[model samples]
Target: MEAYWRRTAMWYGGVGLLAARVVRNLALPPAYTRLVVREMELMGVRSLGVAMIAAVFTGMVFALQSAANMARFGAEAYVGPVTALAILRELGPVLTAILVGGKVASGITAELGSMKVTEQIDALRALGVNYVKRLIVPRLLAALLVFPLITALADLIGLLGGAAIMFFERRADPWTYWNVTTYWVLPRDFLMGIAKSVVFGVLVTLIGCYNGLETEGGTEGLGRATTATVVHVTMAVIVSDFFLTKLLLALFW
Candidate 1:
């Protein structure tokens, strides 16, 4: 128990320190523009297809299930609003974060772990270069900038998926479905969801980088750290979502 708590404390402390350094050194140089653009392509453009597919399926499922339940209660017409509310407020952000955590976070860990084990990171340090500024900053900034966009895209695609279900499955008019959905969903809800995505982006990148930096034991350790990065980021996003949701509700409601 003592060792467990000690390890946990060390992990958190390391992550906190990394976050502080990233924030302090956030000023971008002209040269870093290329790096940031590369990261944006890798993290944002590459992940779009998967995120969209997940959003569509999720919204379809939610609409189908909710429509059934609402029909039983003679409130089928309200299904559009309920589906939009749920997707925009919670599912879009959380699901997109989870997908990004699994894909991008794992890749970050693996790439960094490989570099660490190969002594490339130390080589940079030997050359008097700040690896954190050169490597971590670009990825972090990419995540921060791209995640909210992804979340918004997911929310929009998810709404379209729900609208499809309402029209085809529920036999509701397309215009009516969208009207109700837009009427019921407030701007604050959309903003709050985007806010959650931003926080999630920070968590995913930070956790991935920390695990990669701390990896040991050579090749075996690299694999372990990569796996651990995915697990830790997924858990962190989920746990944080609960608290963020409550806080947003208190602030907005």
Candidate 2:
């Protein structure tokens, strides 16, 4: 038990150091603008379709389930507000972050782990290049910029999906559903979700890069790092969500 706690503390400390380095590097004129742009394309633009699909389905399912229960009490009309609140305040950002973590973080770990095992990272250092700045900064910046955009998109699409269900399945009037949704969902709710998404984005990229940079044991280690990145990012997002939700409620509600 002592060893386990020690290792955990060390892991977090290392990640924190990496995060500090990333922040410092970000302030400098990017030495790898092209890489940052490419990463944004891969992590943001390429991932949008998948995030949208997941969000729409999540909203549809929430509406369907909530409507079924609310109808028992003839309160089906309230489903709009319930669904909207769930999507905007919780599901939109959390689900999008998890989805991106699986897709982007895993890929980052695998790519960087391979480079480490191949000693390409060492080669960059030997050439007097700051590998962290060239590699980690781009991914960090891309994730920071991309996740909020994706979360916003997911929030909008999720609401639309819920609204559609309210219209077609529940036979609620469109305007009434819209009004109820808007009435319950404040700008603060939207901002809170987006803020959580930004934190998640930074953590995901940092974890991935940390695992990748520390990879060992050649191909097998690369595989392990990739797997670890996915697991860690998912857990981090969920665990952080609880605290962030609590804080947001205290501050905004």
Candidate 3:
């Protein structure tokens, strides 16, 4: 039991230190600016299509479920708030992080692990290039910065998805849908979800980079690291979400 606790503590401590180093490195102006641009490209532009697709499907499915359920109670008007609350408070950020975890985490880990195995990382060291600054930091910055934007996009798309169902299949009154969405949805809900996503982004990057740096056994090692990065990141995101949700619910309610 003591041994397990020590290992767990060390693991989290290392993650914390890595995150701190990433933040410190990001404080340099030129490097920070470049990372921001690079991150926008990697996280935002690359992820737009995926977010759109997921959002549409999520919205559609949500509407189908909510409309069916609410119809039974003659409370179909509540569908808008149901969808809005679900997207803003839960599904939007969580699903967005999952997508980012799969897309960004695996790609970064594979790239870095391949470099580490090929001795390119060593060459960068020989040439006085800070690999963490050049490679890892950009990705970390990109993932951290872009995740919330992606979540925001997902939130909007999901609402539209629900709205589509309300307008078309459910034949819900558009004015009522609009009014409920605007009036009943709390601001804190969106803020909490976005805030959770940022934490998830940081965790994803840290875990991905750590896995890549620790990779061994050539290609096999790289593959293992990539897999591990995705799995651990997804799990961490969910676990963190549970705690954050509990804290927020307690504080707010």
Candidate 4:
């Protein structure tokens, strides 16, 4: 058990160090630029529709649930604040991160792992290319930038979803929702959500790429790394959410 724990810690630590080095030295070479653009297409544009749909449905569900609960206590006026706070601080980034983590991380792991197993990475190395900078850096940059953008979009869509529920489904005056949103929702919530999304983006990219690059033992190993990438990124997202929440509450609330 101790040996297992030690190896696990070292694995994570080594990956963290490698990622830190890569991020610190990030310079957009021409090929890297092309790769980043391609990744943006895959990570951002590809996932937009799913993120929008998920955000809308989640917002609707939150509003309906909150309304039902608040109705019992004659606290329906608080619905707008509730919905806004939930979407801005919690749901938007968290949901968006999950979506991106699954999509981007899995794809990256599979792709890189395949390259590793097929001797493509070896070929790059033999040809005197910087594999980390050429491959990992561009994708990392794309995921980091795109995840936060998606989170912002999700927040807006979620707010709209909640507004629809309040105005159409619950028969509340639209002004009530708008008024409460304008008055009660704090700007810090928006900042916190975006910050959280940025951290999640970093986590997803680093873990996914690390797993892919480290893959061994051929096909089965690639499959294992892909699974591990998703699981690790998801867990990291949840953990980061908790810490960010605590920090925000301490500093802002």
Candidate 5:
């Protein structure tokens, strides 16, 4: 138990140090602005289709379930607000992070792990290239910037999805649904969800890059690191969501 606690402390300490290094390196040199834009396209633009698909389906299912359950209590009219609250406050950010994290983390770990195994990273260091600036900073910056944008879009698409279901399945009035949703959902709700996504974005980028840089043992090590990244990032996003929700509620709610 003591050993476990010590290891946990060390793990977090290392993560903090890495984050600090990322900050320091960003201001140093090369000013890889193009690379940052490239990463944004890779991490954000490529990820849009899946996030929207997930959002639409999630909204549909939630609206379907909520309407069914609430109809029994004669509260079906509130389904729009309920769906909006759930998606904006919790589901949109959480699901988008998990999906994009899982998709991108595995790719990052595998790509970097392969480089490590093939001594390409060593070659970069030998060339006097600041790999932290060249690699990690762009990716981390992209994640930080991309996730909130994606989540905001997902939130809007999800509400549209729910509205579609309400119209088709429940025959609820669309204007009423839209009005109720707008009334209940404050700008704070959007901000809260975006804030949570930003944290998740940081966690995903750091964990993925950390695992990749630490990869050893060649092909087998790459496989293990890739798998571990997905699991660790998913757990981190979810567990942190609870704490972030609490903190945001205290500050804003």
Candidate 6:
């Protein structure tokens, strides 16, 4: 128990320090604009297909189930609003964060871990280049900038999916569905979801980078770090999600 707690404390301290450095060095000279843009393409544009697929399926399932329940209550017309609210408020952000978080986190960890084990990071340090600025900051900033957009895309695609299922399969009115959705889901709900994704992005990037920097044991350690990055980011995203939702609800609502 003592060893475990001690290790946990060390990890917390390390991650906290890494996060602080990232913020402090965020505006370093030269801007690393190209690197950041590259990361955004990798993190956001490359991730579009997966995010859309998840969103569509999510919206479809929720619409089907919500419609079934609402039908029993003679409230089937409200299914659109229910599905919209759920996706905008919770499903879209959380799901996008988790899924894309896993992919991006693992990639960052693997890339950095390989660099670390190969002494490439040390070489950059010897050259006076800030690894945090060059590597961590770009990825972190990219995640922060793109995650909200991804979540918004998820929300939009999800709505369309729900409309498709409802209009075609259930023969429901698409205009009414969209109208009810727009009427029920407020700006605050959308903002709340985007806010959650922002924090989640910070968590994902930092955790991945931290694990990569801490990696040891060469290739074996790289493997472990990548695996740990995925697990840690996923768990962090999920646990923080509850607190974020609670806090955002109080603040936004």
Q: State every prediction's TM-score relative to the real structure.
A: 0.97, 0.96, 0.90, 0.95, 0.96, 0.97
10-120 per-residue lDDT for model 1 (tens digits): 999999999999987787453598898999999999999999999999999999999999899899989988998899889999999999767998899889988999999
Give residue 74's error in model 4 in angstroms: 1.1
The Cα RMSD of model 2 versus the native structure comes to 1.2
Residue 114 shift from truth in candidate 1, angstroms: 0.9
- For each candidate, what is the lDDT? 0.91, 0.90, 0.84, 0.89, 0.91, 0.91
* Candidate 2 per-residue lDDT over residues 39-118, each given as its tens digit: 99999999999999999999999999999999999988789889988988899999999998789999998998999999
lDDT of 6 by residue, 1-253 (tens): 9999999899889999999998899877869999999999999999999999999999999998888888999999999888888999889998998899999999988999999999999999999988899999889889989999999999999988888889987889877888887898788888888998999999999998999999999999999999988889889988999999888777756
- For model 4, residues 171-236, the per-residue Cα lDDT tens digits are 998876798778988788898999898888888888888888889989999989898888888888
- Where is model 4 more than 4 Å wrong at Cα? 28-31
Report the poorest 10 consecutive residues by lDDT, candidate 5. Answer: 7-16
lDDT of 5 by residue, 184-249 (tens): 878888889999999999999988888888899999999999998899889999999999999999
lDDT of 5 at 115: 91
RMSD in order of candidates: 1.1, 1.2, 2.3, 1.5, 1.4, 1.1
lDDT of 3 by residue, 10-86 (tens): 87787788778777877664575666697679767988888879987998899889899889999888889889999
Score candidate 6 by lDDT.
0.91
